[model samples]
Target: MKAPLLLHVFPGFAVGGAQVRFAMLANRMGPRWRHAIVSLNGRMECAERLAADVSWERVPFAAEGSLPQRLQRTRALLRTVRPDLLLTSNWGSIEWAMANAAPGGVPHIHMEDGFGPDEARGQKARRVWTRRLVLRRAETVLPSATLLEASRHLWRLPEARTHLIPNGLDLARFAPGGQGGDGLPVIGTVAALRAEKNIGRLLRACALLAGEGLGFRLLIVGEGEERAGLEALAGELGLAGRTRFAGHMPDPAAAYREMDVFALSSDTEQMPFSVMEAMASGLPVASTSVGDVRRMLPPEQERFLAPCDDVALAGALRPLLCDAALRRELGAANRLVAERDLDQDRMFSAHASLIERLLMSRAALAA
Candidate 1:
């Protein structure tokens, strides 16, 4: 018998948290399932991470036309492909969810990562109603408690169908020990330079740290449309000398291994993979108190999670950069958490079990 086919729909297949997680899981699962990926916007940068042996193909589909036309097209394609399972990611792929929302539609799962800049502070009522209506029968996966609760009470998704599975990392691949170089401590971040990521906020915070005479190097590892604008902002903030924009790396393990402190200044996030990698690599994190970040770190390290403000973020980074002992202490605690809870094996098992169960149930129904 042929392996079951799993179709994954993404807003864009760029290298971000969602795409990277999909690539990791697909690589691990190997030939257990055939995979089809559709990048709504046609950006397939993250596909480079997939292993050569994985049974997967990218579906050449770009989202076009008005809502009704797009929905009709998606539903027609779903009928033609007749996948064993359909996995739609985030709000950007909601149309796919809507297209597959029929009573006997293919076994569907919707993954909610987080909101974009428009809905960063609060979710739009229109979207709330739409999700509540369309995602009623689908299995909903949320990576953070914040989103899980929102899915239950706010979106009013069925309790039984909703799942809270925290994102995980390969703890062994990221280990503690970046020899604190004599030149300057490296404060690093691995995130797509997007508006919602607010890399500019981080740059501004680092500028404040520099004004206070703190010596450190900023290493940004990722690529996006916002690069030129962010580089300009760095120059304006006088961070041109200290900051390095190391554009998209296939693997950011070395970047994490080189950092003394990790930073996240995004306006929104739900269990960002960068923080998990940093923790596994034993680097203390100073970040905006967004999504599940505060809960991800040890209690002692919560002080470093500041509000989304330049001065507050700077203050959070100050103590971590000033005292070497604190960094080591927090880094050790973070590594312990990663080992105990965030191992990729646990995530692989949970996701695989869920997918297999869904495929089996759908097959039984079909039979």
Candidate 2:
């Protein structure tokens, strides 16, 4: 039989959590389906992660014009592609969901990877209503319990159609390794230098530690438009000497191994892949408590997580920096948690089952 075509739509396919997860999924499920990806903003940085054997291509999309006009165009593209399944990512690709909203259109699945800066604090009414209206019939996937709860309470999506599938990591690649190169401890974070990631908060927290004569290196990994501003902020805070912005490491497993502790300062997130990778690498984490992070980490690591404020985050990091034994203890616990709960094989199985079920259901309906 012919391989079914699965078309994925993302707002901008930068190397973020959602895109990386999709890449892992596509790579693992190679040749089972022909994959067509559309990045609305024309950025496909994460495309390199896909294996050579994976049958996938980028589908051109014109996101120009108003919402209604874009929807009309997207519908035309959908009809032309005639995919067996349509998968849309986050709010930016909601218009694609609208385009495929008709009863007889392609089978659709929507994945929500938390929010951007705009809706970090709360959800917008318009978006809630739009999701409620457009996604009633489509399967909705959320990678965090926090987001799954929001889908039911805020977006008012039905329980039956919503799936909570946490992001998973390859535990073997991120095995425990020696940390700290020089005398000073290394505190690191892997995140796109974006506003919502709040890398500035991490910088400021480190600055607070530095002001008290604390000695450590801060390594900020990943690249984005916010790099220049964050670099400037690091300089302004007198952290230029201690901070290193390691931009866009294709394989971040090594990045996690380089650090004694992993930091997440994002104002918004939902089961961030960085945190999972860090845990798999057997590193203790110091982070702003956001999304499912509080739940993802071991109970012992909770003291290291603070509210979204810099001072609070700094307070959380202070102890983790000073105590080597505590870091080792928490790191080991984190690795255990990852091995027990965050294995990628389980995630791959869940996704494969979901895809198979959806395809079979669509075939049944057609019959």
Candidate 3:
């Protein structure tokens, strides 16, 4: 018998949370399931990470035309592929959700990571209405408490249909890193330089630290549309030699190793994998208290998470940067959390079971 087919639709198949999660899941599951990926924006940044053995196809989407036209295109694509399971991610893939609303549609699910800059102010009325209309029939998966609650209330999804699957990581790949060379502590962040990520806020905070005669360097990892703007801001803030803009790294394991501290200055996020990765790498994190970040950190480390701003973020990073002993103490605590709760094997098992259960349900319905 043929293996179950899982079609995943993403706004863009970049090295973001949704894409990375799917890649890791596909690699772990091996030949148990076949995969189809659709990227609306047609960018597959993380495609290199997929296992060589996984049978998968990428259905290209040019993202042309108005709302109705896009929906029609998605529906036509669905009719063509006719996969056993349809998986969509975030608002970018909402049109696919709308496509699934048609009569005799394929069994579908949506995995929401978070919103883009468009919803930075609030969930717009059109989006909320669209989500309510299209998501009624699909099972939704949320990896963070923030997303789960948002799905329940904002999208008005029933609790039963929403699964709160907290994000996990490959802990051993990011096992507690040892001390780097005896140089100044490195303040680093692993985030796509995007507007929502607010990398500028981090740069401003770095300036604040510099003003106080604080001695440290900043490492900005990951690439995005906002890279130029961030670089310009860094120059304006007089953080020239103090910051290194490492465009994009396939493997962030080495980056994490060199960092003495991890910082997240995102104005919007649910469960950032970077923070969890930093934790697993035995780095103390000083970040904004967005999403489930406050809950994700150790109790002792909670004070380090402030609102996304120069002063708040600077205040958060101050203690970690100034005190080496504090970094190690909090870093150890963070490592324990990553190992105890966010193991990748545990997450892979959960997804495998979910797929099996969903496939079984589809079979029963077909009968």
Candidate 4:
């Protein structure tokens, strides 16, 4: 029997959640599926995160130029790969749907993890119309309930072709460690220093706590375009020494273990992997109310504040930091939630099974 061929297309292979998820899926699926990744822009940073044994491709198409040139490049790449199935992600690669609309008609699957800062809380009609037209022939994969609704209601996609597949995490790698500081409280957040992540809010919140004479250190892990601005904000807020920006740690699990509390100040999200990883690391989280966060977190742990509100965020963080017993209880509950739903083995197996089923169904239709 021949192995199935799956080609994944993205805007760029950077260190984002979607890229990480794809790498994990490719590594875990192993020999059963042959994989190739094509990024519109030439950044292959996330490719390094893939398992050493997995064979993949990194095709870069220049994003600038006339529409004809762009479409021509996309069509050429599709013809070259001749994949059994073509999977494109988000708005950036939606153009691939048009490029792949040839006679043999390779099955197209488009995954929408979430939106960027430009369309954070709502849908853009122009983009939605384009999606409806370009994605009409493709099967849509929505990773969260919020996205599922967006596809069905906002984009008006057909129910038959839209499928919901929740994002999963690696439980074993993120498990809690007993080793950490026992002195002043520590609050931490792990994410790219992007504007949408709202790291500035976290800095301000920490500064407010510092003003109250509560000694706590805020550790931010990950790096991006907003690093310099965030660093400046910390200094401006008089949190220069109280906030530590750890730029792009190879393994964030150690940082999570060191944290007494976890924080997520994103202005937008849909089932963020960082929150799940923190919960798996057995830390209590105080995050903004965005996407399905209120639904994903346990009822007791659901202290969803408005995005970038330092006062509200400080109010939420105070209880978690000041009360040790509550922290232990919340952490234990979070661990249980992670074990029950976010185990990587289970996640990998679920994705493998879904892909197998998709292939089998396509074969039967062809027959």
Per-model TM values vs. the true structure: 0.98, 0.98, 0.97, 0.93
lDDT of 2 by residue, 20-107 (tens): 9999998898888899999998999999999998999899988899988998899899889889999999999998888888888899
lDDT of 3 by residue, 205-281 (tens): 99999999999999999999999988898999999888999988888888999899999999888888999999999
Model 4: how far residue 301 lies from native, Å: 1.1
Model 4 TM: 0.93
Each prediction's total of clashing residue pairs, residues at least 3 apart in sequence or on different chains, is 0, 0, 0, 0
The alpha-carbon lDDT assigned to residue 19 of candidate 4 equals 84
Model 4: residues with Cα > 4 Å off, grouped in runs: 101-103, 304-308, 361-367
| Cα error of candidate 4 at position 222, Å | 0.7
Off by over 4 Å in 2: 180-182
Off by over 4 Å in 3: none
TM-score of candidate 1 to 2 decimals: 0.98
Please give me the total number of clashing residue pairs in predicted model 3: 0
lDDT of 2 at 170: 85
lDDT of 3 at 230: 88
Q: Which pairs clash inside model 1?
A: none
